[model samples]
Target: MIRFENVGVRYADTAAPALAGIELTVPEGELCLLAGPSGVGKSTLLNAVSGLVPHFTGGRLTGRVTVAGRDTRTHRPRELADVVGTVGQDPAAHFVTDVVEDELAYGMESLGIAPDVMRRRVEETLDLLGLAELRERPIATLSGGQRQRVAIGSVLTAHPRVLVLDEPTSALDPGAAEEVLAVLQRLVHDLGTTVLLAEHRLERVVQYADLVVLLPAPGAAAVVGGPAEVMAVSPVRPPVVDLARLAGWSPPPLSVRDARRRAGPLRERLAGCSPAPPRQVADAEPVAVVRRLAVRRGRVEALRGVDLTVRPGEAIALMGRNGAGKSTLLGCLTGLHAPTGGSVQVGGAVPHRTAPRELVRRVGLVPQEPRDLLYADTVAGECAAADTDAGAAPGSCRALVGELLSGVPDATHPRDLSEGQRLTLALAVVLTARPPLLLLDEPTRGLDYAAKARLTAHLRSLADAGHAIVLATHDVELAAELADRVVILADGEVVADGPTAEVVVSSPAFAPQVAKVLQPQEWLTVGQVAAALDGGR
Candidate 1:
């Protein structure tokens, strides 16, 4: 169990407490979700639970915090490691061992568990998290989602009484996310383990939460209740809840099944109408081309006989399971990886063969690990350097960042920003080049619905202006909102590629919640459905 009594946190430089007068209790075996807008101190609250607030983070902690009756104020993270296991937003930062199997066992080894027990737990965790195939893969070679599973398995292997995760499923595809959440459910029901997580993708996890704690703003009082009660008033909610509100459904539904039950009348009313189609692709020559691309890394064939083409005014989403070659394909386009066979051309020049300066003008990439693209300590410094490197106007990157997420201070450290904010900064850096082709991997991992909407609008404008975009992501809702085409890959090959609606509107694994609720109708987003009814009215 976790308890926070009159708890507040303040850093050295700030006068106001990052968290103000928070009081809450999470019962043993219950899954407690920390919900709030970006930069609203969700991560700060999680750190408090795991004793990272005042201990390692160098922040002032007031009031009492306890986990499993152990006072975190007095206990350092190392002292509480047996009772608490924590996984932060970025998984790669937590790995000490280079190999997946070794990483999973590292936690238990530190805890001094018996070797036999550790081995058994490691195997169980690998199977539980669907990481059996990747057990021997190097942590460096694994995809972002693969690294996430390894991080979680490492934590689960320790068998701590309390589990704390920040955005645990952000990098996982739909199927893998379900597997991890199901494992959590089993832990809570079967073993009475406590789970505390902060996540932005509510649609994936809200239905499973035993309690929801809403921090409305940076210093707002905590609102604690059942999931439904909190979701009704929460500042950020999933598309399903939004649809319920728009249709006057009492006690808003949390899952797609429940919403579908109440959608009969609404569906009938819209039977005669159709949602507006996305922007038409302009008649232009191919901006980039991939022909029979085959990329081999060690023994793994990351891509095999894959083909794709992009044109100006196009937004394409590359989707697949973990290790399914989505990121590998994105790397190919950005010239990060050379193909073993076939050809890739962007702006009529081969990406892997193009000069560095020429590649900057022809193509740009915002990789899955947004931090990889960041080097400067301050936000303003980063923006200024981006402008200089790309020969763009001064303040161009800052203006683009402002459009994405407003109010990021110029002097703030890039490391201090949330995962969502870092991604925004990286995106601004890439867009500064104003290249003919743009590539983004997991573009919306940490962004909330509002920030994602802004991103959608901005990308839509770029597409309209004849810039080509490709997004390799696990966020199905994002694909529904922004992508003109959806290209799915599996086992390093393209499996499904078509218009966004046609590809995802009916698929069980890939469909967004709105589309799932209004199946057979090709409605992909809440905005589109609302606009359709509003137009009819």
Candidate 2:
């Protein structure tokens, strides 16, 4: 059980409190979802629950916060380790050991648990999180999704009464995300654990939440209730809720199955209408070409005999399950990984052979961990450095940042910005070069709906201006909205590649929420159906 009464938090040098007037309660044995826009203090609230707000973060905390009847202000994170397990947004920052198995057991060892008991709990957690195969892998060698699961397992092994997770499923594929959520459901129902999680991919978790907490904006009080009650008025909503609204369904469906059951009439109405056509680009030369591309990392063949091409003004979505070679392929494009065999060319030059200064203008990458691309102490410094490195105008990078994500202070440290804000800054850095080819790995990982929409618009404009964009992502809705082509990879090879609608509509796992609800129809988004209805009327 977690309770907050008149809680307010404000960092030094900030005019307004990051969070204010927050009154919330999470009952025992319930999974409560903290929902809000980016930079809206969702993470701040989670830190408060784990006793890290004022204790470690050096922020001013007001009022009372208690977990399991113990005041958090009195108990530090280490003091509450027996009852509270917290996993932050960045998984790599949480690991203390190099090996997967060791990292999972480190938390328990710190708590001074018996060796035999710790071993048993670690094994149980490995099986629960599907990490058995990765027990011996080095932490640095694991993929983003693998690291995410390991970070969660590291905490889960402690068997804390309360679990706090931030963006738990953002890095996971749909199937893997379901597994994690299912495990949480079991913990709440069978083990009587209190689970509090904040996630932006609402379509994956909203249906499973026992309670939904909506923080409309920074410094605003939160609204807590059933999923449907909160979603009706919440600023951020999942795709299924958008569909229910578009179809004029009363009491909007919270899950795909519920929406599908009532979709008969809407399906009939959209039967004669087709999904929106992909955007057209003027005929131009190929920006990049891969011929029989192959990459081997250690003993694993990360990519195998892959052939692909990107033309000017085109958008491609690289999609697949975890460890399916998506990131490896991106690495080759950015010259981060040397191909074991085959050839890769960007703008008629090999990326691996290109110099760093020249490559910044030819190609750019926004990696999964946005912080890796940032090094300056403040936001303004990073922008200035990007301009110097890219040989761009003095204000170009800052302008891009303002356009993509507004209200970010120039003087704020890059580390202090929220995950989404960091991502936007990284993107601005890459865009400053005006590279002909752009690659993004999981760009929507921490972005809320509004921020994601802004990103989509920016990418569209870039494509129209003759830039090639390729993004490796697990966000199906983003693919549906932005990708002109969908390429699915498996086992280091391309399995399916075609136009967006043709590829995703046929695959149940990759289909968007609207596509699932409007099955037997090919609609992939609420915007498509809304357009059809308006045109028909």
Candidate 3:
């Protein structure tokens, strides 16, 4: 349904083209996945299919791109709205109306569909995406995952033949992500709708794809084939694929159940071996302390009597389902929102009562929306400003950004950059402060496995240097890699807190793929298995 012929995109004033020599076709009624590292033009390619690359983005498109028999070069996004629906990385930017119901119907209204038809489709989409309860809620009041579902519903309600989505499930929890993926599967199988998805979180979506198109390197042509074939050679892969490679299994499995079927011998080999325990922090003064904290936003009691303590040289993962008060607790630490009751302290000072400049030095926050930490028109400008604000050396933030995601130019605007690239930039900006306490919200939302590895190693080094790390994330693999402790929250309360392996392996909803595949064993990651095989453990 979508065809790219000799397609190459080059943004002005860049060292190399964002995409090069891309030639591929996405057949009708199939789910095609775009897999690649950060800053490799996956988002740019998705934009091209929806006629946003050259028409709205001002980039040069060097080939003919067609969707559903119509040339995107000639048919703009508005003209192709009936045939194609596009949802970008950021959901908040996609909404046109304040309320959920209105937003879902806005797309159908734009197409001049009859009011009755629009209402029917909207109601169907709301039910499909489990958004019926949020039908009348304001967009601004919803959680990150909630807004993502609403954004997808708004597109699905239009009943377009083709759906182009970038990171559709990045903000969603495991269950919610499964619901969205199931909806896409139904659309493809039952309705014969074509889906072209670009997602960094492959663990949730890779197994569901009919075909995988892998961009192995930046500016490289894509390799298209069956999901397993592409993943066998793709550097960016999920934990299950990594495990398959470590076990030397042929035709790597894509799902946990498949891997489990093939993991009998490996599990027996590991029967006598035990994974290393989580790091233990020594007795020391706490970096942040929260005692019986409560926060109420409007009519919702976002957080209720939560207690948490972070000491130096420790990494903690705050995990929960959507609207479980994870973000609210993070806000309390950063002083973005004051507690409704109880006491919250960071570096021995009350966070919400502390001064902005002084508080930033003690604690740095990389928010869920990375763009919230960015304002400059260019990457170089943002880096310079970060250096000035943090009193760090010149170009420190740029160096960090380069390490996290390579091939990002200094002149690229944060808005123009890919979601993963923007996130790395925000992380770099916060790292420049070298704060004692570092907080990240969904830090791995858009990061590929390779980029995520680089980030994990960097954060590990910081933790080793006595910096306390607290991450509010849904990426269980990330928590397995970096977090020494896992804290699960439910409805504004701390439900569980303990060592990473103990907390995650006990909960099926939050368990990583490796742990799920190798049950009865406490192995949290493929790296642990690899290390033991290589005699590193």
Candidate 4:
């Protein structure tokens, strides 16, 4: 469906070409997984294929690019619209309509399809994506997942043979991410549509992909093959893969199911693989408190009568679907959003009532999108400026920044980095503030297992050091591993709140594989699950 022959693209402002002599092809109905560190021209290649590179972006293009036998240089985005459907990481940026059904119809209407055909396509797409219930809902009122689905559905209505998604699930909760992936699978299997998607959260989606494309960071070589081949040889492997390697297994498990199936023999081979005692944090003073909190965002009541408390040395995972009030609750806790009703207290003082400068010392927030925090030219500079006092050693800040960049996979351009890397950088900058309470919104989004594990370990250490953490995430495994408690919100209400095991395992949408495997045990983290499985073995 798509082909790039010696394709080189250079943006006017940049010294080097965004994409350098990229020779690639996408066969009809083939699902291709494009993997690369952020800013290595993954987006550039996609843009070229979709005719947005030279046409809309105004970049110099060299070499031939073809999609469905049509040359990209000659075709504009609108001209190539019927053959390809493109969705980017940020769905909100692409929204052209305010309503769901209208958004779906926008693409078809542009194609000059008959009104009857447009109506049918919109309805079918809504049903296919499980958006029939939300057809009348305002796009702005929808959750991150719902909005992404709408963006995809709007494009899919065009019945394009090829679908190219640039980290489509970056903003979605785990459940919503799964829904989108499931839709992608269905399209490839049932509808025979070609899919080419780029994502950093390889642990979740890699297993489902037929082929994997691993592009080296900035100045490295690109590798492509079946998922297993590429993932094994890649610099960083997922946790299960690492476990497999540690156990001396030939081929690593790609998914949790694969891990469980292969773990039996591996456990037998590695003796003394017993579970460690659960991490214990000593009781500490309360750093933040929220009681009967109600937060209103535009037309949506994001939080309704929610009560929660975070103590120093506690890592709390807030889980919910997109629009489940996770972000809103975080905003309320961080003083970014004032509670419409109820109260929020940081260090026994109301967050809103606290002075901004004083609040900087008590609480730090890393918003869901990392772009909000990045403005400096270099990663080192961004972290340095996050400090409250001028006397802090620049050497210490630079060291911390370097450590954070090294910890994440493919740390290149702060702006061009993947969602996961950006989140890590943002958190690293926030950490420079030395705030007691750290509020992370979807901190695990777009992270590979290794990156996620490293981050989880860091959060665990932070909690051990008496820093309270409130992480709004869709990752149940992360919650299980790092958070002492899990608070679930649905439709602006705190639907579930308890220990990580209890809340995560009980919630159908947010539960990870291990949680389902050990249903009654309520194990939230991979370590806990590994221990349980070790015991059973």
| Alpha-carbon TM-score of each model against the true structure | 0.98, 0.98, 0.98, 0.87
Instruction: Encode model 3's per-residue lDDT on 44-117: one tens digit a residue.
Output: 99999999988998879898999989998999989999999999999988989999999998888888999989
lDDT of 1 by residue, 1-537 (tens): 899999999987764678989999999999998888887889999999999998998888999999989999999999999999999999988989899999999999998999999989998999999899888889998989989989999999999999999999999999999999999999999999999999999999999999999998877899999999999998899999999998889799999999999999989878888878777998789999999999999989999999999999999999999999998888888788999999999988888888888888888999888889899989999999999999999999999999999878898899988899999999999988888899999999888888989999988888888999999989999999999999999999999999998899757989999989987788988888899899888
Residue lDDT tens for model 2, 1-537: 899999999999987788999999899999999999999899999999999999999899999999999999999988899999999999999999999999999999999999999999989999999999899999999899989999999999999999999999999988899999999999999999999999999999999999999998889889999999999998999999988888888788999999999999988888788866778866678999999999999978899989998999999999999999999999999888888999999988888889977787889999999999999999999999999988888998999999888889999999999999999999999989878999999999889998999999999889988999999999999999999999999989999999999999999889999999988788888888899899999
Candidate 3 TM-score, C-alpha based: 0.98
Q: Could you arrange the candidates by TM-score from highest to lowest?
A: 1, 2, 3, 4
Please write out the lDDT profile of model 4 over residues 1-537, one tens digit for every residue.
778777788766565566776777777877899887655677777788899888887789999999899998988888888999999877878899889999999988888999999988888888777899889898877877778889989889999998999888777777677878888898899888999998876756888898877777652445768888887887655555655565555676688777667666644533444335545656666788788888887766778889887888888888777778888887776677888899888876677777877787788898877888888776656656655342366655555555654643222457655565677778777776667899998786666555676777777888888898998877666776787888888888887887766666666777765555334444444555455555766
Clashes of each: 0, 0, 0, 2
What does each candidate score in C-alpha RMSD?
Answer: 1.0, 1.1, 1.4, 3.8
Report the CA-based lDDT of candidate 4 relative to the real structure: 0.75
Against the reference, the lDDT scores of all candidates come to: 0.92, 0.93, 0.92, 0.75
lDDT at 233, model 4: 84
TM-score of 2: 0.98
Candidate 4 C-alpha RMSD relative to the actual structure: 3.8
